[model samples]
Target: MRYIIVTGTSRGLGEAIATQLLEKGTKLISISRKPNEQLIEKAKYLTIPFDFYSFDLQEIHQIESFMEKIFSNIDVTNVSSIHLINNAGMLAPMKPLERSESEQLIANVHVNLVAPMLLSSAFMKHTKGWNIDKRIINISSGAGQKPYFGWGAYCTTKAGINMLTKCIALEETDKEYPVKVISFAPGVVDTNMQAEIRQTPKEDFIQVERFLTLKENDHLLSPDYVAKAVIELLETNHFDQGGIIRIDEQ
Candidate 1:
C-alpha cells in the first residue's frame, strides 16, 4: 500500500485531502493538534487503514521524536510509495510586525516553517535509500511571493518553505533514488484561514476588504476541489521537482 503522512488533518484542505486518500484505500497517517473524530469514523466505516496522532507543530524540538513515533507503524518492505504532506499552517498575529507579539511571531514561524524543515529532515534521514517513490509536498501561499502589509511572519515563513523545497530538490538531484519535493500554492480557499482574513481589521490588513468582497461574491475555491487537484498530482506523480506550483496553473 502507498503510505501518506499528512499534517494539519483536523480541518480545511488537510481534512479534505485525508478524506479523499481514505476513499482511495491508501494508508494514511495524520498529524494535528487534535483528532478529527468524523474522519476517524469515516475511515472505520469504510474499513480503510487510517491512523491519527495529536501533535502541535509549534513544538519544533520534539518533531524528530514525533516523526519517529509515526514512522514506526510503516512496514517499508510492503509500501509502494511514501509521501509527506506538510499542510498545517496558521494566519495569526494579524497586526503589523512592529505591533505583533513575540510569542505569536515565534509560534507562527515554528508552525509554518521550522516544523516542516525538521519533519522533512527526519523523513529523509530515516528513509535514505529505500528505493521507492518518496515525495514531500509543502503547502504554500501566494503571499510568500508577494509582499503584504500585515503578513510579515506568514509570508516570510512560506517563502522559506519555497526555498527549502528547492534546496531539497537540488540536494537529491544526483541520488539514484531521489525524493521529489515541491511547494504548492493552493490559491485562496474558503477555509477558516480565509475567515480569519475577512475578520482582520482594515488597519492591520489593507487587503481585508478585497477578501470580504471575494467572500461576498463567492470567489473563494472549495477545499475539496483544491484537494482533488493535489491528490491527482500525487496519484500520478506528475509534478515538477523543485518547482513552485500553483493550483490555478494545474
Candidate 2:
C-alpha cells in the first residue's frame, strides 16, 4: 500500500488531492488546520491538525515540536514507501510595497518556505537509503516562477520554495537517491485562496480586474483538476528526474 502524506487538507487543492489519492487506494496522512467533515466521510484516512497559521514555523520551539510529531506519526520501515506532498500555503491581504504588513510576510515565509523545507528534511532523515520509490511534490505557483508586485511576501516565499526544490533535488542526486522531487505550478485554481486574493484592494493589485474576470468567467481550474493531475504524476514514474511540472503540462 502507498503511504501518502499531504498538508493543507482542510479545504481547496489539498483536500482534492487527498480525495483523489484515496480513490486510487493510497493510504493517506492528512495535515491541516481543521478537518473537512464531508471529505473525511468520502475517504478513509488519518488527519493531523497543525496550526501553521497561528503557531507559525518562524518560532524554533514550534518547529521542533512539529518535526517531532511528524516523525512520531510516520513509521519508516521500508525506504521511500511514502509520498510527501507539501501543499499548505497562503496568499492574503495583498498590498503595495509601502503598505505591506510585516506579519503577513513572516507568516507567508513560515508556511510557504520554512515548514515545507523542514518537513522534507525530517522525512528524508527518517527514510534515508530505504531503497524504495518515493516522491516529494512541492506545490508551487506561477507567481513563484515569475513575478507579481502586490504579492510581495507570497511571491518571495514561493520563489524560495522553487529554489529550495532545486537544491534539495540536487542534494538527492549527489547522494545517489531515487526519491523524486517535483516543484509544480497547479495553475489559477478556484478555491478559498482565490477568494482571498480577489479581496485585495484595487490599486494594490496590478491585474486585479483581470484576476476577478478570470474567476467570474469560469477560466479558473477546479481544485479537483489539479489534484488529480498531481496524483497521476505521483502514480506514474514519468518524473524521475524531479523536474518542474505545471498543471496544464500535466
Candidate 3:
C-alpha cells in the first residue's frame, strides 16, 4: 500500500491531487489550514482511508512533533512506499521588497521556504530506518528561475526551494535508502493564487497586465490537469533526483 502526505489540500491543486489519490486507493494524509469537505465526502463515499489535518505550516517550531504524530497514527505494516508533496504556498505581499512589510516578508518565507525544509528534514529523520521507497515533490514555480518585478519574496523563496531539493539529493547520495526528491513547476494555473496575481496593482507588479490577459484568454492551466501530472510522477518508477521538472515541459 502506498501512503502519501500532501499539503494545501484545502483547495486548488493540492485538493485535486488528494482527490485523485483517494480514487486510486492510496492511503492519504492531507494538511491545510482547513479541511476540504469535498474530499472528506468523497473518501467516505468510496470507503477509502483518508486523514486530514488542519495545520498552519507557518508554525515552524511545532512541525517535528506534528510530523511525529502523523507517523504514529499510521500502521506501516505492509506499506510499499511513502511520499511527501510540499504543495502549500502563499503568493502574498506581492509588492516591491522595499515597500513590503516586515511581518509579511517573514511570514511568506516561513510558509514557502522554511516550512518545507523543516518538514522534509523531519520526514527524512523519522523514516531513516525504513527501507521502503521514499519520495518528495517540492512544488516550485517558474518565478524561481526567472525574476518578476514585485515578486521579490516569492521568487527568492522558490529559488531557495529548488536549491533545497538539490541539497537534499546531494546529502542522500551515500545513504542506504535515499528519498528521491524533485522540484516541480506547475506553470500558470487557474487558482485562487492566480486570482490574487490578477488583482495586483500596476505599480506593484509591472506585469500585471500580462497576467490579466492570460486570464482573459483562458491561457492558465487547470488545477486538475496539473494534479494529474503530479500523480503520474508519484506512481512512476523512474525519477530524476534533484531535477527541476516543469509541467509545461512534459
Candidate 4:
C-alpha cells in the first residue's frame, strides 16, 4: 500500500491533490489549519488539524515528536512507498518591502519557509529506518525564481525552499536508502491566491495588471489540471531526478 501526507488541504491546489490521491486509493494523511469536511467523509483520509499560523515551527524537537505521534500507528512494513507533499503556503502583505509590516513578514516566513524545513527534517528522521521508498515534494512558485515587485517575502521563502530541496537531494543521493526530493513549481494556477493577487491595488502590487490580464485571457491553469500533472510526475521515474521542476514543463 502507498501512503501520502499532504499539507494545506483546506482548499486550492492542496484540496485538488488530496482529492485525486484519495480516488487512487492511497492512504492519505492531510494536514491543514482546519479539517476538510469532504476529505473527512472519505475512507482512506486521515485529517490532522494543524494551525501553522500559531505554531512555533522553530521548536524542532516538539514538532518532531508531534509528527512521530501522528505516524506511530501506521504499519510501515505494509507500505510500499511513502510520499510527503509540502504544499501549504501563503501570499499575504503583498506590497513593497518599505510598506511591509514586520509581523506579516515573520508570519509568512514561518509558514512558507520554516514550517516545511522542520516537517521535511522530521519526515526524514522518522522514516529513515523504514524499508519503503520515500519521496518529498515541496510546492514552490515562479516568484521564487523571478523577482516580483511586491512579493518580496513570498519570493524569498520560495527561493529558500528551492535551495533546501537542492541541499536535501544532495545529502540523500548516496545514502543506503535514499529519499528522493523535488521542489516543484506549479505555475499560474487559478487558485484563491491568484484572486488575492488580482484584487491587490496597483499602489501595493505594481504588477497587478499583469495578473488581471492572465485571468481575462483565460491563461490561468485550473487547480485540477496542475494537480493531475503533479501526480503524473510523481508516479513516474522522473520525479526527484532533479532538484527543481515546473509543472508547466511537465
Candidate 5:
C-alpha cells in the first residue's frame, strides 16, 4: 500500500521506473506532461500530468496549486503512503556556461532542481499526518560530480540537486523523522537526452564522437535496467539511513 509519486513518466527513465514500481506492487501516482496509454493500463497507477519544460518551478505559487491538485486526489485516509522519485528533467542542448541558452538554463534548474524540491516538500507536508516510512529519491547524474563539457545547465542543476538532497537529509535527521532523502547518479544511458546533447555546437560542448562511441559500443544501459537498479538500491538497507547513492558504473 505504499503510495509512490514519480514525475517524468511520459517516457524514458521516468516511465521505466513507474512501470517497474507498478510491477513490484505499489500504489503509484505518476506525473508527466502527457499520458502514456501503457502506464494507464497498469493496475496501481494513477496518472497525473504536468509539463516540466514549460512550467516554471521558480513560480512557487504554480507549484503549490499543482501539489494541491494532487493532494486532493490522494485518498489520505489510507495508512500506508510515502515515496517520490523526482526524475523528470531536461538536458537542454548542452552548452557552455557563458553561451548557454537563457531559457534552457532556467528551465533546466527549474525542472531538475527547484520543482523536485517543491514537490517533495509538498508531499512530505501532506504525509506527515500519515504513518509510513517516507522517502524521496532524486535521479541525479554523473555530470554533476565532474566536468562534462556541453552539459552546462544539466550539470549545474544536478549539482544543485545534490546539495538540496543533503540539506533535506540534514533537516530530517535533526528532526528525527523517518523520512530519508537520497540523491542518486544514474550513469550514461541511451536516452533521447543524449541525442540532444550530441547535437550541441562543437565549441559549446564536448566532442560528439565520444558520445557516438558510447552509443555504438552499446555501453548505454537500458532505462528498464536502471529503473530496476533504483528499486534494488532502495531495498538494499545500504542507504537505509539516507544520503547520496549512485548506480554503479555497471
Candidate 6:
C-alpha cells in the first residue's frame, strides 16, 4: 500500500488532498495544528496534532524525533511507496519589509521554509535503506518567482522553498535509494488564504482587488480541483525528473 504523510490537513488545499488520498485507499498520516474531524473518521488516517505556530520547528533534532515517532508504528516492509507532502504554509503580516515585525518574519520563515527542510531531512534519514519509492512534494507558490508589493516575508519564504526543492532534488538524484522531489505551485485557489487577501486593506495589499476580482468572476480554482491535479501528478512518472512545477502549467 502507498503510505502518505501530509502536513496542514486541517483545512484548505491540504484538507482536499488528504480527503482524496484516503478515498483512493492510501494510508495517510495527517499533521496539523488541530485534528480534522473528517479525516479522523477515515479508517486509514492517523492524525498527529502539531501546531507549527507554537512549535520551534527549527529545532532539527525535535523534528527528527517527531518523524521517528510517526514512522515507528509502520512496518516499512509492508509499504510499496512513501510520499511526503509539505502542504502547510501561511501568508500573513502582509506589509512592506520596513514595516514587518522581526518576530513575524521569523515565524513565517519557520513555518514556510524551515519546517519543510527539517521534515524532508528527517523523512530521508528515517527511510534510508528502504527499497520503496520515495517522493516529496513541497507546495510552493508563484509569489516565489515574482515579487509582489507587501509580500516580502511571504515571497521570500516561497522563494527559499523553491531553492530548497532544487537543492534536495539535486542531492537525491545521486542517492543509491533516490527520493523524487518537486516544488509544486498550485495556482490561486479559492480558500481561506484568498479570503484573507481579499479582506486586506489596499494600502497593505495593493493587489487585493485582483483577488477580489478573481472571486467575483469565479476565476479561482477550487481546492479539490488543485488537489486532484496534485494527486494525479504524484501518481505519474511525470514528476520523477523533478524541479519547479506549476499545476496551472500542467
lDDT of every predicted structure (CA atoms): 0.91, 0.76, 0.93, 0.82, 0.74, 0.83
Candidate 2: the clashing residue pairs are 79-130
Candidate 2 regions exceeding 4 Å error are 44-60, 75-80
> What are the per-residue Cα lDDT tens digits for candidate 4 across 148-241?
9889999999999999999998898788888888889999999999999999999998999999999999999999999997777568876655
Residues 152-204 of candidate 3 have per-residue lDDT tens digits of 99999999999999999999999999999999999999999999999889999
- TM-score, predicted candidate 2 vs. hidden true structure: 0.88
Each candidate's clash count: 0, 1, 0, 0, 0, 0
Question: Could you give candidate 6's per-residue lDDT for residues 1-250 as a string of tens digits?
Answer: 7888888888899999987887444667778877787676653344432222223454535777788778887777678898999998989879888888988888788889989998999898988888877899999999999999999989999999999988888887768998888888999998999999998999998998999999999999999999998887678866745678898677
lDDT of 2 by residue, 90-176 (tens): 885487768877887777778888889888887787667767777899999988877786888888888888888888888888665
- Candidate 6, residue 5: CA error in Å? 0.4
After superposition, candidate 5 runs with Cα above 4 Å error: 42-60, 240-242
Compute the lDDT for candidate 2.
0.76
Over 1-250, each residue of candidate 5 has an lDDT whose tens digit, in order, gives 5667788888889888877776443667777777776877654244433222223345655887788887787666663646888888888747677877787777778888889888978877877646567778888988777777777778788888888888877777756455777888888876888777667677877577787788888898889989988766556566744456677832
For model 6, the superposed segments whose C-alpha errors exceed 4 Å read 42-61
Query: What is candidate 3's TM-score against the reference?
Result: 0.98
Q: Which stretches of candidate 4 lie over 4 Å from their true place?
A: 44-62
In Å, residue 99's CA in model 3 sits off its true spot by 0.9
Q: RMSD to the native, candidate 4?
A: 3.3
Per-residue lDDT of model 1, residues 80-105, tens digit only: 88999999999888889999999999
Q: What local lDDT does model 2 show for residue 45?
A: 40
For model 1, where is the 10-residue window of minimal lDDT?
230-239
lDDT of candidate model 3 versus the reference: 0.93
Index of the highest-lDDT prediction: 3
